[model samples]
Target chain A: MKFLVFLEHHGDALEKGGLGALGKAAALGEAVGVVLGEGASALAPGAGAFGASKVFASEDPALAPPLPQPRVDALAALVVQESPDAVLFGASVLSADVAAGLAARLEAGLNWDLTDLEVRDGELVGKRPALGDTVMVDVGWTDAPRLALVRSGALDPVESGGGAEVESFEFETSDFSTLATLVEQTQEESTGPSIEDADVIVAGGRGLGAPDKFTLLEELANALGGAVAATRAVVDAGWYPYATQVGQTGKTVSPKLYIAAGISGAIQHKVGMQGSGTIVAINKDPNAPIFDFCDLGVVGDLHEIVPKLTELVRAQRGS
Target chain B: MKIAVCVKQVPDATVHKKIDPATKRLDRFGEAALNPTDLNAVEEALRIKEAAGGEVVLVSLGPEKAVESLRKALAMGADRAVLVADEGAAGSDLLGTSRALAGALERVEADLVLFGQASSDGDGAVLWAAVADRLRRPLISQAASLEVGDGTITGKRQTEHGYDVISAPLPAVVAVSDAINEPRYPSLKGIMGAKTKPQETISLGDVGVDAGAAGEAGAKTTVLELGPPPSRGDSVKIEDDGSAAQKILDYVVERRLL
Candidate 1:
């Protein structure tokens, strides 16, 4: 069976999530990776190491634009021409955008937020959390080019692998139609670390007592060279910026060490962070759901516990 | 420059919404709301217009009552609004919705366009791409933060392994992440102004989108079934006390839950 993987790009190579997603598509069949930008070949070894047989570069001037239509058309057109058994797109925000458009264009079944995937007995099966982690759904599709947007951070990039050989396949665009016009593009400067990609996240909530308490977390984040994440409550109270929220409606994180202070682990929030390698929860509520999912549970005031822990970690570095 | 923001009214996240056992799908009446994420799009568009100086038009495709969402957008300081209403559009799958949006976009000369990264309900980010494809423009998705320059737009995109800093050309369709900005409420003057604002409430018919291709009938992948996620088996309440820990340990060993 042949499969197509869509790659999202940052510059000349793959966007982290798109690269990871192409890694995912490699699991389905003899992989045919499709790229839309220049220097995409630099990103091919990762896909190849994951099992892609070849790469198809669209080489469109507009491929690198962080826009949806051009990316969608490039992938959709390639999928249509390739007639692969299934297609995979990164679950990142941009990948989600392309998957939605491609899924619609291909009229293929779509399963979102997939965490694990495989090709079993000629069917593509994906596992995703459902009902707040109470249930796990295993969805499968037999149709050709069955489209899926695998969740960002769901699968780890293969750690021990060499770049795969690159043999260019054809990227065709004859059947594609461009509907939207590009008027202008602008990119914003980042202030804090992107929440979804932070390694060590220090998240605060209403339990922080008052807005001022976030100061310590900020200091800790600065010391650790990390980002400060917030609960919806903090943002609602105007104590923190909404951009720093970490939850279902917010950013989902898979950091190595996630420290939740003063925040009651709402189920939605838990779903977003439960995947962290080691979760440390500090809430006065001993029965908080967050504790149930944590590697270490500290039943105490965050204002008191966090400062001490922050000092401990920082002092460990002797900085 | 005129910009269009594709918006949606969704169940508020905080609201307790449960799908009815009978229909096994979204219970809209469960808790009505304007999708919080879309508000980011509305806010971003208004901010752009405020900064760069342009008109912002909000568009939505849903039930007639969805005019409330458009009105809310107006209250949020949108310069204009459009509601593509038709029962036929109710169940429009992603493609149908995209086709509908594409038809409307063709008629509207928007210099820039935006959408919520994904609607909280459908949680699908299609409109930006479909519209972009139909319009033949570059599309940027998941714009966590956006800055517009004299001739280019740049921002960081969340990716699988890390964030990507990307640049795109003008007239791009962007899906704004909720992190972009908080939405503003309609000011007293803005409320009064919205009343005077020219909002052309067009139906699906006006857009020339084939009703057959706009909703359930037009949808490609139909939901044959919708149900709650499979439930986890009963949990053995593991007592954590040192004495009870033995039982928990025994249970863990017996089950190999580790």
Candidate 2:
């Protein structure tokens, strides 16, 4: 089976999720990378290391911004041109829009929030977690040119020590596609590695008592050379930025160490971090659902214990 | 400035959802509530209607029972509601659902279309985009804040790295995030008046969608199997007697995490 993987990039680096999807697609069958935007061709050649045997690039100026419609138009044209068996994306704010729009444009089927994909009996099957991540369901498409959006961080990009042949394609954007304009874009001011890339994550939930209490998690994260994350409740409450949210509607992380402070361990949050190497929970409620799954559960007031733990970690790390 | 808000009735978030063993689909017989974020969209539309001289019409696609959810939204001050209910539309995936919704929106002919970022049940978060594409309109998603001006609307939305401010013309689609605004509770008077409000339920054929092109028949994806998630293994619990920090540190050290 032939697969086309959408590779989203910022400046020069390709998004990890897209690269991971490309890697998996290459492992399964012939994988081609699709790159768009001003510098898309520059990023196309690098797709080889991540397992794409060939890269198709469209450097249309209209596709430079992170808008979805233009990319959808370009991708739709490519689908009609190449007719790949499937189109895959590593889920993101932008890629989700593009994938869904492409699906609508092509009148094709899309399976989203997928955690895994494999070929069984000559058919591509997707594994999706549903019902609050308590159940896993196997999903498949009934027709060709299947579209799928894999969950963020669900796959890791692998280096195959190969090179890809780069090809350029041309496409037209519909008038409606150009109707929306990006006025401005600004990054959140943050220090340390991002949650997705952090080795350790110190996550705070409503149990932190107040928004100001998040400083405790931040300090702990800083001491451990990690990053701080928050539950959807806190983020929705404006206690933290949406970018740091870790849950069903947010980015998924698989850090080496995940410390849940004052979190009740809702399934929404559990699915995002369940892949961590070591899971620890600090909560006052002994009956908190987090205790049922965490590798180590500490029943205590996080306000009291988090500070002490931060000090010990600071002393041990000697930072 | 006529605005149409798309809403959904999702299984209650507090309830432990289960998939039916026979159908491999979520059992919807349990308690249900209007999707939380869709309320945000409704609230935004109401605010826009209050400021501008226009009507707020609700558009939904679900079983007939979903009228309950529409009534709740109507009590929040929407003018009227239209629900495309048909057995042929059941078990519809994102694409199939978007087809029917796009058709309904076209029939509504509102200047502005609104939707929540995603439904808590499927959590696909991309239906608005699909609908927008099907309707051939501009789309903006994850809007944290919105400003309507002459023939145009600007939205501020959060992204993984930062935030973006996007602008699109009228006759476009926008999906608001939970951060957009707090939804208002139905007033006593509004609740009483909601019963008299106009609610029309139609079928897929009414929206010009063929029976074969909707629901399970039009769905391009199929569920092959269902089972429980993998276990996380055993856990060790300890009560804090002023020594919890020390124990946690020891566990971290054993794993060399620090």
Q: Tell me the spans in candidate 2 whose CA falls farther than 4 Å from its real position.
A: A209-213, A275-277, A303-319, B241-243, B253-258
lDDT of 1: 0.66
Candidate 1 C-alpha lDDT tens digits along B1-258: 678888877776787655444533456774567777888888998888899998898877777777665777788789887777777787565667777887777667787778886666645455576566656665666667888878666665553334455666667777777667777888888776667776776877888887677665765443333334443233333223333323422332344322
Interface RMSD of 1: 7.0
Candidate 2 lDDT over residue span B1-258, tens digit each: 899999998888888787888877778887788998899999999999999889999999988999998899999999999999998998888877999999999999999999986788875888999999999999999899999999999999778888999999999999988788989999999999999999999999988999888999999989999977777778899999999999999999998888
Instruction: Report how far off residue B44 is in candidate 1 (Å).
Output: 3.7
For residue A13, model 2's alpha carbon misses the true position, in angstroms, by 1.7
Poorest 10 consecutive residues by lDDT, candidate 2 chain B: B116-125
Residue B82 accuracy (lDDT) in model 2: 93
DockQ of each: 0.14, 0.75
* TM-score, first chain, each model: 0.82, 0.91
lDDT of each: 0.66, 0.90
- Of candidate 1 chain A, the 10-residue stretch with the lowest lDDT total is A174-183
Identify the leading candidate in terms of DockQ.
2
